[model samples]
Structure formats: structure tokens, C-alpha cells
Target: MQNIGKIVVVAAAALSLAACGQQAKTETAAPPSSAAPSSTAAPATQSKGRECTADDIKTTGKFGEVPTITIPDDCDPPKKLITKDLSEGTGEGAKAGQQLKMNYLLVTWSDKQKLDSSFDRGQTFDLQLGAGKVIPGWDQGLVGIKQGGRRLLIIPPDLAYGEGGNGMKPNETLVFVTDAVAVTAA
Candidate 1:
């Protein structure tokens, strides 16, 4: 019975390969379970494609059909920063070893929600930037802004969440209104 089963499998394999336009030199290699042979190799991926627009990004896009990702213009409430003469922090704005006191509000691109906030709570956090401790976007976004300056950051998922986005939801783009008020380096 086993031998019979093997023969049937081999026959199926040979037939599938032939259907795929693949030719086998040795009849012995024609097994029923053999993968279908293909005359054409898989298409190569393009290195550069059309440039992406704001519409292409999504916060819930990663949720797969279950959740929809959307980024609206009002995600962060469009507002130009008021001019402040504070010199942009230079030469390692926030010391690598230091902690920073910052006020921020993070919102999801889709159905904008206040995922997190520091100022809303009348509190501030001591963030250690570039310590692989904070989100990559935060580490990089907070780089040049001065301690007393406020800035807005539009972080793509690649820099913010990569693949698996914020807990519960898939990685999604985030918008932040951040103000740096202090930095303390030990």
C-alpha cells in the first residue's frame, strides 16, 4: 500500500511540473510531491517606485481588513510654531546621558486620539534620548530643538513603530506636539 501511495504522489508531481513549463531531465526526479517547476523566475522587486504622498500612510493600515488606517490633516491641528529666539540646541542638543523634561501629546493618524500626553496631565517626563530606550522617532525628532523651544513632529511608522505599532494596534504613524523645557545630565 505504501509503495502504491508513493507512485501516485510521484505521478502527480511530474504532472504539476510539466504544467508549470519546467522540464526535468531525469524521469526519476518526477515525483508526485515535487514542487511545481516554473520556467520563469519570480519577478524582481523595484528599488524605486512612485513617491509616497501623505495619503499613502496609515495608522490602522496594519490591522489588516479589520481596522482601517487613516491620516487626516487635522491629526495634529495644523498650527505654525510661534517664533522663539531660543538658539537651537547645538552639539548634541540633549546630552546622551541626560534626562529631559518635555511636554508632549501623541495622536494616532486614524481617528486621531490622544494616545498619550505629558502636558495634559500637568506633568513632564525625564526622557533619555538615543538610549534605544525611547521610540526611534522621539530620539531622532528631539535632536536639534532647543530646551525652551516647542516643535511638532510627524513621525512615520518606520521610525515610530516599524512593524508592530503601539501596543494593541499595529504600528501606525504618529503626530506629536512637543515642548522641551529642561534637560538634566548626570
Candidate 2:
């Protein structure tokens, strides 16, 4: 039988490559799957009333639907990777080194064009958290999130495709809405 899970992983990889200029690498060659929390990480502070948060990202959408994201009026990208939990999960929180199964939508920050979405394939994308299997933004941003939770990630170019962009513009920030479907022990 066709593994929907594998299909999802390939879709995620292809989408990531299209959005960012990352060279293709096999999952086995990826770095270790765990990120140690850093003491110098950016501080998470509350913002202007209901919308005040460190990432400064806003969104509106329902489950299984594409979400619309709004950046600050100035449109300046965050310096660090920003992760905000959109919907809470009931399962155990994901840990570094675990394989995460998820559904995701990737979009370009400049034009807001969707680069990829697992929802289209009706499958769940899977990756080892903190491993080099994906970009630094994903490796770092997804840590500590619980399975079944939805999160928004705002990634800077350095963590994404860098100066040599993939299918996107150079040094452009990227946005993603990710749903954590499941987590497996490493």
C-alpha cells in the first residue's frame, strides 16, 4: 500500500526546496534530532493587548482550512525564529530527537504565495525534530510543542534559504502554519 506518511514527507521536502534554496539531503544524513534550549534565546513578551506577542504575527482560520497571516504594518521580519501556538494540543508535548508527524502550509513572506501544503495531499508530513533533515527554523521552532497543536512559525532568511534563495527571493523571510499530528520516540 502507498504510505501516505512517506508521500507527506516528500511533499514537505519538495515544498521546502521550492520555498528555500536548501540542497537536497537524505533523512539519514541529517544532524542529531534534538535542540538544547539556549539561555540567550529571544525573550517572549506580550504585545498591544490581544495581539501583543513576540512574533508579532496574526492569523485567522479554522481547522483544515488555509489560514491568513498578517504581519506588522511595517512588514519588518523578526530577527529570530518566532513560534506561537495557535491551538493547544491534548497529547504529550514534542521533544527534540522525536519524529514529528504534521500537516503544514508554507508561504513566502514577501508575496504571501503558498509554496506548499500537506493539506492538499491529505497526508501528514513527518520529520525528526532538531535534525538537519529540515531548515533551522523548523528544527528550532517546533521544539516543546505538543502533538495535535497548531503553531505559526516566522523564519528569517538565515534560518531558511539564506542569501541564495530557493524558488523565492533572496533573503526573504518565510511563514508557516504547522499542525502537530503525532510524535514518535526516537
Candidate 3:
């Protein structure tokens, strides 16, 4: 009879420990699918009170112009690069090693300062995608974009200039509004 009672107590303790382990997993573990940014991942439109996509962000100039941007005051920059399509294109999608002619407006994430504008220069910027001519964010963000599409890239520092900024500031997160004007085969 005493042996049976001891066995019951031991089983109960083991069950209690097992419950704790299950609880820990549920509380701290995210699904493997959500761990990395994928092309299919939905934009975190709910990140702040405002959406980070180009159309949702406040602009100062006329519609379709190279407008000044206003970032949400309460939101922190994302830890990973985020690509959101502001307007989808009907042309061929971009691929690695392809030459892309794009119009871009770059703004520093911290202060919303305009860093670069291809529109102001009155010419589309050309680069070979995934060929190291630009930051990793541009390479990755341009990969799946179609010609004539407008994309918004929210690039974390690591994907942009990293700890050493691109003559702007160190560890600066960059926001780019890019329009894929043309794509040529590699």
C-alpha cells in the first residue's frame, strides 16, 4: 500500500514538471515560419498607429511627386528589412543579376531626412540587382519586384549601412520608396 502511494506522488510530480515545460514552450516559442522575413509575409501594417507603406505615410508634395515623408513617432524601426508593394506592376518581375532602372527616394529612419532622390536628379537610377552595387536591402527588396512597380523598403541598419553609415549616420535605418522603371536581362 505504501509503495502504491509513493508511486502516485512521483507520477504527480513528473506531471507537474511536464506541465511547466509545455507552458514554457508555449510562452516563448514562435512558429518556425514566422522567424524569418519571407516574400509572402504580410506587411506589418499595424506596427504603429500608422502604416509604414508609402501610400499610408504622410507626404508633403503633390500626389505622385517626390514628397517628403513623415514616420510614426511611436514606432521603432523593424529588426529586419521589410518590403511592401505600394503599387504592383504588370511588367516582368525583377530577378538576380538583372539591370534595374529605378527611381528612389531615400529617407533616414531616425529623422525622416531626405538622403537621396533620383527623381530630383531627373533620371532613373540604374543598378545591377544582387550584384553588390548597393546595400543588401536594395538587392533583396528589388528581387521580386516587377518593372513599373512601386515598393517601399524599410531597411534595418544591418541590411543598410550597418554600424558604419553611408556618409549619413552610423547604425541608421533607411526607408526607401523605389519605383521599378525598367528591367533588363543580365
Candidate 1 per-residue lDDT over residues 1-186, each given as its tens digit: 010001111222323433211232111112222332233432333433343343333433110112222444433322221122222542346655566666555555544665554444455545565554455556666666667655556665445443331121233455655667676664
Q: Which ten residues in a row have the lowest lDDT in candidate 2?
A: 26-35
Choose the strongest candidate by TM-score: 2
Better of 1 and 2 by TM-score: 2
Global CA lDDT of candidate 1, please? 0.41
Error of 2 at 107 (Å): 1.8
lDDT of 2 by residue, 1-186 (tens): 111112223343444432222333221112211212223423334443342244566777755576776666444567678898898787778887899887777766666666656676576677777655666777778888787788888877677655422333455566878888887799
TM-score of 1: 0.50
Residue 46, model 1: lDDT of: 42
TM-score of each: 0.50, 0.69, 0.66
Candidate 3, RMSD to the unseen true structure: 20.5
Ranking by TM-score: 2, 3, 1
Candidate number that wins on TM-score, 2 or 3: 2
RMSD to the true structure for each prediction, in A, is 21.2, 9.3, 20.5
